[model samples]
Target: MFKVPPRPSTSRIPYAPLPNQGNDSGATPKASSPARSHRSSSGSCFETPVAAPSSSRRLSYAVNSGIKPSRPSSVSKGRSSIVAPAYSNLSSAKKPGEDPRPLKDKAYQADCIQNIYAFLESRGFDKPFDAGMLQLPSSKLFLKIFEFVMKQIDPRFKYGNKPEDDILDFVKGLHYPYNLSRSSLQQAGTPHTWPPLLAMLNWLVQTINFSDATSGPGTTAAQPAHLTPRRFEAGPLTNLTSETSPLDEEGCRAVFFEFMKESYNVFMNTEDETISDAKSQEMMQLFTTYFEEARQEVALDVENLKTELSRKEATLERMQDKSELKKLQEDKEILEKLLSDLIKETQRGEKDLQGYEEVLLDKQQELKKCAEITAGIQEDNALLCKRIQEQRFSKDDIEHMEEKLARRKAVLQMLKENRMHAGKEASKVEIQKVKIMEEIGQAAKKFNQRAAR
Candidate 1:
């Protein structure tokens, strides 16, 4: 007898009620069939069984006999009658030996189920099955589903006598990212082993979707029409083809020569003395058609080449223009920077001119005072000249007059020296003023030039 492992006490396995079954509160349910009992036992071995209601005798009987209890009519039909047990709901706070690994969330499992169903429906699978069927401990239906999905990839592919080997081979060929051991593959339909299998199926579906999206008719149509070559239409031998032929003009000529050679050989070696005129005409016509097609093909090629060359030349010109435009832009930026600097220098020069104008005003005031003093000195000199001209003296008074004249000459010399020193200082000031004015003129000219530009 095969012994089954004990189920964990933390979880509960829910069973879907049969469609024909009815929930009658008053009536007592019959005992489960042997097959139902066996399935229930297996389910119990995999997950903890839910507690039956103590008040209901039918529920207690069903639990004792390994049969799922029916729910009241008030309960929702969409959900199973069995209440799923949770770790938090346990009466005991602690367990001595519990598996530390966490279980997959219900939401995740539901998502997987929905995706699997959607994939099957898109692949045109017509058979009806629910999530409950997938959760059952059976491999037959799941294997069939797996095979159906594999067939979508390759219709001709078939499972051989060794299905395990075939499955391994197919999975290996796909270069599946997840490692799939033989034991996992063997127990694929069981609840304990379904997660990896589900993952694998989902991956395969995604790959198929991706491949279809990448290589479908829509993708082909999205490509540029000019990129693909035009295919020649098939026609009879008498028709003059305008498109390219399989053989070139040289090949056609060779064939014609070969035909002529064979004809000559036949005429010389066989009973026939000369070739038939109709056959010769037919051969010539065929060769002529071939040559015409070859010529047209060559012409088409030349035209294509010319168009390509023109396009390339235009592209090259655009590229060169772009480079020149970039260079011009850089040059413009440099010129703009220089112009800014020149403007700043011009502003500074204007400021210096303002200060120089103030200094020039002071220098003009000093020149005015010096001119007044020179006018006073000129009056004094004029008086002295008049007095000297009017005076008449004897030989004894000549010495006294000479001594006074000497004193006047010394005063005149000192005055002359003062006038010369003042003139020299005025000249230096004028030179400085001229230099400043020149600089101001240059700055203004440069500013005007830049502004015009």
Candidate 2:
């Protein structure tokens, strides 16, 4: 038996199998079946499993095939989106003799030509002939007309009195009816010269027309006869219109040049206005951006000021804390001095108490000796009383004995009271010594801790 490849797990997307080529009839597979049974070319039966492609792979395939994905069934009915048809059809016809531009471009060109012809007619270029018969004059006749037109247009232009001298210097210095060589015409840089030529003529036409229309009847009459408008013989112009004679096309091109020159001003003015509007808009946008940047900078400066203020406040607090610490140190020093003084006083008091104790002990010893003497004297007195009872004595002797006994009794009583007073003074001195020692101990402990810190 042939082993089939194991299917991928649930997370992985499987590659879809192509439909059978042997079966000409197209029928979709059933979803209810797990696998479809197929017969191989060798007539062996095998099962082929169908697996759905992943959404990501399907989207990638659609993108590669230049197809857009459809919305979900909830948004739109459960159907795949249809593709839009591309516009590929183009016209094939060609005119026999014409510029190969679109119909819209040709129409625009025609309108421009008509406007030029209208402007020429209105300016009396075809004064001698009817308005419909506008045409070019011969070179000789053209020179006369050119001189006359220039004299009317510019009051400063000087002309020759003699006929022979009229054509003199005509060919010199950027003169009109400019030379057109094949090489000059073929150069890429030559076309730029035409617009300036047209602009100059356009300015001239406007100046001339404005002077004429605004001129009073008295001013018109004062003008020279040659400058005055006049009709011309139609001989050269008639010849230009006929196809029989073969005059150079340049003469005819000159007529169109004059016509176009008059019409150029309108379009130039419109373009200038558009350009100025665009420039103004750009300036406004730049100003707005600068204002926003200025506002942002101001906000940043405010934040910096706030931070600086906070720092200053913190520094002030630290300084205050340092001053407080200095005060505490001063107080500690004062307390240490007081404790040292107390300890010195305690030492002196201990010394004084020791001297007092010695004095008190000496007094106690004296009192004991005095008490022994007093007891012996009392025994002698008792013996004297017995002797008086045995043998009668003088009254003077008895009186003297009584006086001596009273004196000894008074001395003994004073010694006993002095001993008691000394004992109380010694106990008080000891209590004061203990208190001073405790104070000194506490002060020393505090001083050591401060030194360690």
TM-score for each candidate, following the candidate numbering = 0.26, 0.16
| Candidate 2: stretches off by over 4 Å | 1-321, 390-453
Residues 1-453, model 2: lDDT tens digits: 101112223433322121335653422222222222233475332222222222322112221133222322221123232110110000001111221222233333233234334445554454453322213223344333444445443333444443323222221111212232323222212334322222223323333443442222212443333232211112111112222211235333332232222222121122355553443334334333433554686688899999999999998888689787899799999999999999999999999999999999999999999999999999999999998799866799899999999999999999999999999999999999999999999999999999999
How well is each residue in 1-453 modelled by candidate 1, as lDDT tens digits? 101112113232112111122532212222221110011332221112112222212111211122222322221124332211111111111111222112244544555566567667766776677656655426777678777877666554556665655666555444343456668777777767776666556555555544333221222233333222222232112322334343645344334443433232222223322333344344445555655776788799999999999999998888689777899799999999999999999999999999999999999999999999999999999999999989877788998889999999999999999999999999999999999999999999999999999
* Candidate 1: Cα lDDT at 31: 21
- Indicate the residue-level lDDT of 148 in model 1: 81
| Alpha carbon deviation, residue 412, candidate 1 (Å) | 99
What overall lDDT, based on C-alpha atoms, would model 1 receive against the true structure? 0.50
Candidate with maximal TM-score: 1
Candidate 1: where are CA atoms >4 Å away?
A: 1-103, 218-453
Q: Which pairs of residues clash in candidate 1, taking residues 3 or more apart in a chain or in different chains? A: none
Clashes of each: 0, 0
